[model samples]
Target: MIEICKKYDCVGCGACISACNKRAIFMHPDSLGFLYPVIDQKRCVDCGLCVKSCFNNHKPTFIEPLKTCVGHVLKVEEQVTSTSGGLASVFMREIINNEGVVYGCSGENAHEVKHIRIENIDDVNKLKGSKYVQSFMGLTCNSVVQDLKANRTVLFIGTPCQVAGLKAYLKGKEYDNLFMVDFVCHGVPSQQILNDAIDAKVADNGNLRLVNRVKEGGKESKYTLRLLKEGKIAYDQAYPSMGYITGFLSGLYYRENCYQCQFARRERVSDITLGDFWDRHDDVKGLNNKKDGLSMIMVNTENGKKLMSMCKDSCELVEWDYEDFIKRNGQLKQPIRRHPKRDQFEELYCSKGFQSAIKESLRGDLNRIRKIILFNLIDSTLSTIPIIKIIYKQLKLIK
Candidate 1:
């Protein structure tokens, strides 16, 4: 009898279900909105087709390095409305203009992130910016396979692992129209955390209504959240906090396999991988002045180079040295901080869910305030050699 573990390690790839010759495997949805495979061991012949077809255990396709590739450091107008550089949107625009469909994650309602297909350029608005959470793959993999079989041009944008899974699922299949783009992902949070955060916000303010999770705000926008309370506009007090970003970087919020991600190596499955150019030194003043940030562009394949060239006019193209780019945003072989307290704090905050986490975050904020006050008092009592000068400068900047 073939046995399968029904735990967190099972990523719900459904390869086992598809590979079962006796048709014993089936997909079952769990409480976390992820689907896992279930098997009827009684009918199982244990032929091992399921294990052989599993992408999780097999080697993925790799693209050979291109001889000559062009790298661009461009300021995208749409990127201002994006979580990172607007390279994904620019790439989608070109693909859509040629009557192609783009597949990516978009916010639905207020909190949910769902996989969507954008054929019309107008529909591109839905796919903009960072969701900060792991998007449900849903039936997208199956859909992409069908679209490929029909000879439709498709541009699939996702994290490195998702891209690898897609290519692995469609192994031995080739299509000229298919393009894959992966992000320089820090990490992804659980979908449950996102939902809980939104729910907590709504519960806190009875009239709080989430308008849109936007990267850009027009004149009416005061903060990230646009709320209607007692016929008055209210915004999220938390803007640009390190909660989500830090959580991702610390790996306190990703899936079980993300920490040991096989896709983080040099051999990438996607044609192009894009990330924020956070450490660029070219005209820092100009780049910083803009509301939207710049992106670190890397063309991993010849096809990526070709696609990037087509969008030269729309973007401010500049040469980015590969060595410098890697030094700034390259993958870490280990966690950011090896201290146990950081991990303990993260687990306490994250596992407590959003409501409890918010309360703890407030306590943290108070602690920070208390430290600032103490530092100021100490500086005032100590010898005055601009002791508190740096702290004052930081406070002014934050304000």
Candidate 2:
């Protein structure tokens, strides 16, 4: 009997499934639609390859970034359309122009999110924005290995844990042509929740498409989730339709493993890390302070430096202090603190649907609501009082 890592530790990167030569490992969604590996008992030869490849069992080495900076695409047309800074798009384009392949998560439809590969610049648009749900990595790790073996330059962009899983799946074989990039992950809610939200909005069964984290007036709308049915707006992230994003930001419905993520530290597993530069407007010199998106780039390896060099012509890169960069992004310091109502939220979700469950779970918490309101009030007021801004932020009032 070969035991893979515990279910609570699995990030569902599918590396274990790809590492199995006997095809014994299969990924099945749990009650909440989060995937976990399930081995077929009869097909098992006790080979332990699956266990060996499990990122939980074999942790990848983490290295400090060689360079860190705040950057964004110089082209206004491109920056306005991207979720953050448009740096990822620039990197993808550079890779494609260099005759390399790029793999990234794409929302195939309103209901499905999965890893896909692109070799052309036109296809890079599909991989541009943020897909707030977990991406299904269906044998994509194996594809990465194959591409590397064929002497093709490959760029894989995913969550930090996914990068570790791909490295573990290779059994420590180093590939110079393989470049990995990961974001400062805020943890992922199960795709099922997102699908359910879309279904609730588009009850008429019309053709549905999802455009997540839309930009408004050339500025990224961080709280927006848009749905298109028959090419018209069906559900916008307004009052009643805001349940999914609320739950996501509340940290109430992420995968169980996300609460215990080992990759949430400052040290990174990927060659490069990209994320929204949340502190760009916070007294940082030489930073673009516009409402348009900006990215915090961390070059962790020589390959990462090479990739950044390729994008230098198209981006405005400003070096930044790492401590200030990590201050606003909570995911870089530690895993999200699990919400107190997490279990209750899941229970209500199983009984009622996603929207109703969100309402119920978040209801009857006047004290919490009051605190949030008061925190926002003080934080907002600090802008006018400039002197209190530092004091308010240092208090750490509502973490």
Report, for every candidate in turn, its global Cα lDDT versus the true structure. 0.59, 0.82
- Tell me the deviation in Å of residue 75 in model 1: 8.7
Model 1: per-residue Cα lDDT over 221-248, one tens digit each: 1124344455455545333344433344
* Model 2 lDDT per residue over 171-231, tens place: 8887888989999998899989888877776677445566767777753355656776766
Clash list (residue pairs), candidate 1: none
What is every candidate's alpha-carbon RMSD to the true fold? Answer: 7.7, 3.4
Worst 10 residues of 2 by lDDT: 278-287
- Give the lowest summed-lDDT range of ten residues in model 1: 332-341
Task: Estimate the TM-score of every prediction.
Answer: 0.70, 0.90
Candidate No. with top TM-score: 2
